[model samples]
Target: MTDARPLAFELPPLRAISVAIPLFILAVLLQPSVSARTSRRLRLALLVPTAVLGWISPFRWRIEPVEFAITANFRWGIFSPYFLMLAVWFGAMGESERKNELAWLGFDGKAEKKALGVEEGSTGHSTATKEDGNAGLRPRANGTLLAPKPRPVSPLASPALSLVSNSSLNDQLPTPSPSPPVDPVQPPSVVDAPPSSVNVPTLTSRKNATRSYSQRHHPLRILLDAAHLLSAMRMIGYAGGPRARDLPPAPKNDKTFFRDRLLAFYNAHLVSSACLALQVLDRDGILASYLSYILPHDAAVFVSATLARLCIGVSLWVQMKIGFNGFAILFYLLHRGTNAFLDTLQAILPRRWSEELTWRSRFDVREYPALFDNPFSKMGEGGVTKFWSARWHFLFRATFTSLGYKPTLALSKRLGVPKRVAQLLGAFVVFTLSAWMHWQALVSARYNLHPSPAGLAFAAAHSIPLTSIYPPPSTSLSFLDRNGTFVFFLLQPVAVFLESLWVALTRKRVSGWAGKVWTALWVVVLGQAVVGKSWLALGLVHGLPPLHLWSWHRFVLPTCSLAPMPVFMR
Candidate 1:
């Protein structure tokens, strides 16, 4: 591993610059003095450059294939855009939310604001401050000040409202025009604003708030909260898709540390088992051989690759679960150990000292929720939309939406595009971004592998239509190239639109068993195209580091009878 060659030509000089830019943008957002409009403009202006920098920076770093895949794919490819998306989300926040950071921190400070005579819409200038510095005031023929022009509401505000709105059950009526002027000292309540089309949690809804209410004033806590919202996988504090409705209710607050520990151990066991299974599958190409044997004798190369792609999909799903669960276990153990140490200290110290240190104590298990919902629980019940929204892991949803879907939707609305057409365009944009993200990962992984001239030639040679078997020579099958990875993701939105078309014509959704078949065909068979070649060429079949379960059994449990198996190798 130490001797492995670096993937890129040289170290990128602008990598640190790329990183600093986003942090700077975040800083601007956090600043109370910076107006929301300025922050938004700055963020929008910097997005492309930030993406370009992140994209290029990882390639400059010196690392082996495995290391590069793990480090660069996250730090640069995924997280860079993720952080930017968060910045955009923050920039797009409403004035009421911007004025009360505590609200975002999960503090229900509405009473406090009221006591301080801080009325909603009373503070904070609009985006028109720069252009119409006179507060939208223009000289009338009578020289009387005309009521400040009602600033045209932003279409982008839809998601922001969805995020901060307290209740989903509110009437879905379009916002009424401003009523006759109230007293100068008081303003209409924020509740008077139009309800968001999408249902999500309000900033004051502590139970579902993005951040924990306790210790929220602490800077470190704020940073942690920002990170939590950045990922927003479960959409715990924000608006979620239709699938969110299917999620099991949040874990009750009565959950104990012991229960959390058990949960952690359970997840750890799953991770271990997955790693072992993946190792077994990779060794001697057992999975490859199995797929080959199961495929029909007359199956074309495309058919074989498509079927094999399902295995890759399963492998990816397992890997995702492993990572999520592994992190959960680590967090649980850390909390357990910290609490144990805290208890020991409290027992040794005086009561006064312990009381003073209470705020510094470890987090309660109840503060953390389950990392994932059971995605399989309601599979195919809602069609492709539900599959991606409710059934699939939502780790990338926020990033995809903020960077892709939201902007397109907003722009489409602004352009007078029909509502349905706008939705389709927005969905397509989201998938396009997803496709680019995966393409970048695959391309980076390919570069790191440092394929030889012979291997490259062979890969190119097999790119065309040809058929032999599932487990091709050297497991570097090339019936599909790296571009297939992009194609697979790009087709997702097409599936969604097709489903919509079906509904439009048939007056019913594609659901039940029929929905299952539809999803399988798109995901397993027709959609995979050439993705298998990309993974196989990257030597990703045995991508994960194995646990060496067989070796452990042979050496540690010598009395146990087990057959010898091929060891996994890169």
Candidate 2:
């Protein structure tokens, strides 16, 4: 890595981006235009080669020598929107393509989902699906696909899932069974009046009714009361509510304009990914170094991706001014841009394309929000758990959970590790697996190329912090950071474990906001650190004022080479 210094402006190695990005976009847009089977084949055909090439390390160990298998600087060339875009391509391929991939591997696509108890259309709103030989199952709180099952005749009990009611009062009343989907929010008039023969309580007078503390003004609450009175009616009326998870397949003729996919991916992934690829573009050898960055590359992005343009602007400015490569900036921001790119494609591509990713929902954002505390500002109410699980982009959530979370639990049981120890060790394993996946990007490499410092640094950074999560952080700032890190995932079970300890010790919850604030601060601080040297490595920070005036320059005038500093001007 070169230190930031004034030098002749280099064109930088963006040549591959032109080909890689266009190829990526062309593949995605064309996906829906073809049959699902062909689409899947095309995506994997594009992805496999790109991935194999991406991990071909150019550098040889701490020695900093560039070697090559396919090209002089194979790694950088692959990274130039090549590997990144391919990953994006694989990710954006809709569910149809995904299922096709599974079929090729000889697995029935939906068979596993059925095995997992993830049946669809169980709600009365989706009763139309009952005719498909799947009837009378409800979505669990943790939405997964289900298989066909018999209706619960008792309404409260089923072979599929057991219901443990908190209140015994429910036992006295008839079981609240599935009724024709009704809008709980509908007006009381939508419900029938109680029968005259049935003994019923009524307000003695209008004044009493008006003054009653429990007056039913809200439509839904009123509907609930009506249903209780009409309990025998079974609330069996027709209505509908859309299940949030049942995303539709991609449009057969997706209308994503040719130019939009090109421009969107270029600005987001191409720009930074291309920039990052420059450092090792000319190196050779795979035995020394391989892998990507610190925090995992996210697939679950765009829950906070409104800032795509802002991140892009910052990156370009940093690049033009420094006259170095902008690769390091990719480390800080590519996930957001890639996510934004996918979001753009999804809008025009198909729903299946985006099902691979997860994001923040519009509902209960504060209490049960996605990775971001607020997407617009890129602000997060960070805590370790929140950052890792809910707040940070979940681009790789489904992937990571499958590869790391479940397998770790299974392995732990086999090894007879305690559940508590397993969880702690499992986190390390997950981070380590993240490292290995980064390595999997190599097109050609030797076995000795293991544990690149960059990946080790990433894994160890989190792993060490994790050990301190227990003992409930101390008053020291480092300890506090540790506690918060452990909770959110930067550090572990310590901060998360402290939740129980705090409640036990003080009978009150810890101030979540404090941890959030610390997490946010750490993000800002660590972000600068993570990107700083890498910028130097990528040559993006060779001392010059940033080109923040691109919009003005583009339409009004063409800016010259990177703007010089006051010292240089003097």
Candidate number of the best lDDT: 1
lDDT (10s digit) by residue, model 2, range 1-570: 533332232222444234444344333333222345665556656665554443332222211111111111222332332244344445345542222111110011132224223545444222324333233433333432223332355644322122111221111111111111212111111111111110001101111233323232323333332232221111111011011111111112212322322233334434443332232221111111222232222421211121222232244433322221122223224435655765776677667755433331111111111112232142332244334433333223333434455467668978999765565555555544433332322222222323234333432543422111111112322432322222223333344444434445766533455655645444444433333222222222122222221223222221222222211121
Report the Cα RMSD per candidate.
13.0, 21.6
TM-score for candidate 2:
0.34
Which stretches of candidate 1 lie above 4 Å from their native place?
Answer: 1-224, 227-235, 238-246, 253-308, 332-377, 451-479, 527-530, 542-550, 553-570
The deviation in Å at residue 157 for candidate 2 is: 22
262-285 in candidate 1: lDDT tens per residue? Answer: 565455445434433543343334
| Model 2: lDDT of residue 509 | 39
Candidate 1 CA-lDDT value = 0.44
**lDDT value, residue 243 of candidate 2:** 15
